[model samples]
Every structure is written in C-alpha cells, then in structure tokens.
Target: MAKRELTPEEKARNGRNIALALGLIAFVVIVFITTIVRLGGNVVQRTF
Candidate 1:
C-alpha cells in the first residue's frame, strides 16, 4: 500500500486546523483551572 500525499493547499489547511484545535484546548484548560481555583477558595473560607 502507498501513502497519500497532500497538496500545498491541503497542508496549509491542515496546519490552520491544528492551530485552531490547540487554541480551543488551551481555552478549555484555562476555564477549568479558573473554576477549580474559585471552588478551592470557597472551601478555604468555609474551613476558617
């Protein structure tokens, strides 16, 4: 079996898609971290 090769345009599109996916993942991680911090602060306040 032979592997398929991508044209220049297709490669460019793939690069763009990868960047977009990474950006979205970063945004989600930031939101999750923020939620955890807020939850932790609330727990600390209650303990004191």
Candidate 2:
C-alpha cells in the first residue's frame, strides 16, 4: 500500500497537537517533582 501524504494544514495541526501534548506532559512532571521535593524531608522523619 502507498503511503498517504498529509496536506499542509493537516501537518500544522498535527505538529501543534504534538507540541501541546508535550507541554502538558512537561507541566505534569514539573508539578510532580515539585511536590516530591517539598514533601521529601517530611517523609524521611515521620514517626508513624
């Protein structure tokens, strides 16, 4: 089967979607890291 070529508009939309997904992933990772760092000290010295 022959591969289909994407039109310019479709390509642009695809690129934008990929960028948006990556940005969301990065934001989530940053938030997770920040939360972990903020709580890391407390976690080590808990009594219970």
Candidate 3:
C-alpha cells in the first residue's frame, strides 16, 4: 500500500494534539515535583 500525505487540517490537528499532550505532561511533572518538595525528607522516615 502507498503512504498517503496529510492534509493541512490534519496536520494542524496533529500539531494541536502534540502541544496539548506536552502541556499535560509538563503539568503532571510540575505537580509531582511540587508534591515531593512539599513532602520533604520526612517521607522516608515514616513507619508502616
């Protein structure tokens, strides 16, 4: 089968999707880091 080229709208939608995914990933990373920092070293000292 031959590969088909993407139309302008498809390319734009793909770009937007990529940007949204990157933004979401960045947000999660930021939240994770903030949580870790707020928790500090005491997290390791907790007993079960």
What do the candidate models score in CA lDDT, each in turn?
0.93, 0.97, 0.97
Ranking by lDDT: 2, 3, 1
lDDT of 1 by residue, 1-48 (tens): 898899999999999999999999999999999999879868667854
lDDT of 3 at 6: 95
Off by over 4 Å in 2: none
TM-score-based ranking, best first? 2, 3, 1
The candidate that achieves the highest lDDT relative to the unseen native structure: 2
**Candidate 2 local lDDT, 1-48, one digit each (tens):** 998999999999999999999999999999999999999989899899
Worst ten-residue run, lDDT, model 3? 39-48
Error of 1 at 25 (Å): 0.4
Report model 2's TM-score to 2 decimal places. 0.88
My TM-score estimates for the predictions, one after another, are 0.78, 0.88, 0.87
Give the lDDT of residue 4 in candidate 1. 89
Off by over 4 Å in 3: none
How far is each candidate from the true structure, as Cα RMSD in Å? 2.9, 0.9, 1.2
Highest TM-score scorer: 2
